[model samples]
Target: MADVTQLIHDYLRHNKKFPHVFCAGCGHGIVLGSLIRSVHALGLPKDDVVLVAGIGCSGRMAVYVDFNTVHTTHGRALTFATGIKMANPRLKVICVMGDGDAMSIGGNHLIHAARRNIGVTALILNNQIYGMTGGQCSSATPQGDISMTTPFGSLEKAFDIVDMCKAAGASYVARGTSFHAIQLDRLISSAIMHPGFSVVEVFSPCPTQYGRKNKFRNAVDMYKWLKSNTVKVETLKDPTQKPDDGRIPIGVFRDVEEPGLEERYFELQRKLMGQNR
Candidate 1:
């Protein structure tokens, strides 16, 4: 990873934009930091990187970074990213979306993208609630959790983003949390390098909206919760770690190398063009 000072100087926007829009302890800031370091560490050119975001708290991530950013409609960031990838297969497209933005209205697009195995990185920041709009229960909100919409606790089960992407045929799928900052940095880097559809479901915390409503004392407590309620993926082999009902696993869940959608499409076009000659 690049030096902290250098990472900030190279990736951040103008210095005048001091206080970022995120809450004091919101995990979104951490995610942004990890993302910057990951991109810098990989030595990717700033111009070559395109960051696409949807309508949510996560959408604001694009504004602070110096990368080519596209802020699209609710749950449709993937569509724009797909278009960009098809037009220029060499560009590295990364979509950053909040849990509600990625899994709710945008769920169908995500499934189709994964099914096609497109060459784009989908970085889904799963805060588990509709933080920016209202403290509403999102598709990722845990069952039996209170929210603006689910006053009496949500009866619907939360969507497992990693499993969904893997089942939908994405070439790479990984899970990481804001608490594990270093791991998240590595995970994001790996996802960007992986070909075909890549999904990195990051369990970010919404201290302002989701925290106060839940039992969390504060943002620090939320980070502690992430640390306690999750286990590393490497430790799953032992039978001693069998009962992990509430505790989630954190690490890469799936990875496979294969040709992406654009590669296949362009290859077909090339073959047809040659045939016509």
Candidate 2:
């Protein structure tokens, strides 16, 4: 196994895109690291991969990854990814979206993409608040959480990303935190290998913005909260076990084989061509 430094050096565009814009304790870097390791573990050719990201702190991931990358407009990463996948079905399309990007402006696109079951992997880095846009309360922000836009308290309920994806017909849906780096890598690799639409919701922490407002002492405290509050999906299945005190569930919620949209579309085209002939 290669060392962490070597793995980063080999997979990241460090020479050109070094000195990332993420805050010192932001968890986006950990999520990105897991993504790179997952790609490496799956033996994917970098040339065959296309990374798309929307406008946000998470969007910076496309810049650092050494792949065919696109920084799309805010909330448009999924739209661009869907087009890229349809145009070149051979390419592996991966989208990185922030909580606000995925659940607010891009919510419709996220659901429709999953409904079509396109072979694209969406990684929603859910930091709760809109970290890039001045830490405003986003759709994923938990109830009662304070933010710039919700100084009194966020009254809106949070969206369950994994549940939303599963309900949207995503073939693969999973949730993980930045703290679980190794497990996250495995989950991401599995999602990439899945043949249909996949959604991986990564609970990343924004120490500088969201953390400061939410009364978290620091990044370490935020991570500790995540570690203590998250329970695996499998564990929750037992009737004896119940998640309490605002514990969130994490792990692969769904994974099943299905023909992706690209495959079905090509099949339809073949049939139409035969009819024409």
Candidate 3:
């Protein structure tokens, strides 16, 4: 109770805004809480944190936080965050994006961000369907899942975000479900602390647009599915571990210390200045 009060007092904005725009039972709010708790636990100065969000339901997150925030255009959160980081590398830049915002229109930006090893944390919310726009198919939607646009079921393969980011050279990458909020809190904190480009794919629940179409009774059912279907990444590495029964693996997939683009850029600048002198 005290923690909750502190979180509100320290992190949340004091604006007399109306209720949040998320649908009832939406896991986005849970994701937001996890983020707030992670930042609070880290004891970072609020002024040092910059939260940039892309257009979508996820974009709304920027407005509610007390930290420096930007609601950028769709698929451009990374670009804005990169510029912000380059301008003031001391600031802790974070991006919040929906799956479509991160992987579809913004896919190219995501690749470049990871390739450049920018010093920014990307928190991607994957609710399987486009919850903000119509309940349509998105880059993270499960293959053969039904949505408004895929009434007959989608044939397109969903992007394996963890593997994609790992292959793209992200210094740190992890995945967590809204059902596992505590673990998510840890993953987010780790991502923020990681030096290079960090990606944390959050499997949030879009109860309004996704659960009803998928035949889930309610948000609780969706959460249960997440718990039952996900296996810890650590379990997969254990030699004595039993079969995971094909459950989706969650937890840190990669963590390797590497100099970020900002560090390299400033290093080059120093060398150029020395050459001039």
lDDT of 2: 0.91
Per-model lDDT? 0.91, 0.91, 0.91
Candidate 2 per-residue lDDT, tens place, 1-277, comes to 5487688779778677567889988999999989998888889999999999998999988998899999999998999999999999999999999999999999999999999999999999999988887899999999999999999998899998888888899999999999988889989999998999999999999999899998898999999999999888777755233466558888888899999999999999999999999
Q: Per-residue CA lDDT of candidate 1, range 1-277, in tens?
A: 4378677767888753767888878898899989998898899999999999999899988988999989999999999999999999889999999999999989999999999999999999999998888788999999998899998989999999988898899999999999999999999999999889999999999988888888988999999999999988787875224334768888988889988999999999999999999
Model 1 C-alpha RMSD to native: 1.9
Model 2 ranges off by over 4 Å: 238-242
What's each prediction's TM-score? 0.95, 0.96, 0.95
RMSD of each: 1.9, 1.7, 2.0
Residue clash pairs of candidate 1: none
Locate the minimum summed-lDDT window of 10 residues in model 3.
237-246
173-245: candidate 3 lDDT, tens digit per residue: 9999999999999999999999999999999999889999999989889999999999888878772343458
**Residue 234 of model 3: what lDDT?**
85
The residue pairs in collision within model 2 are none
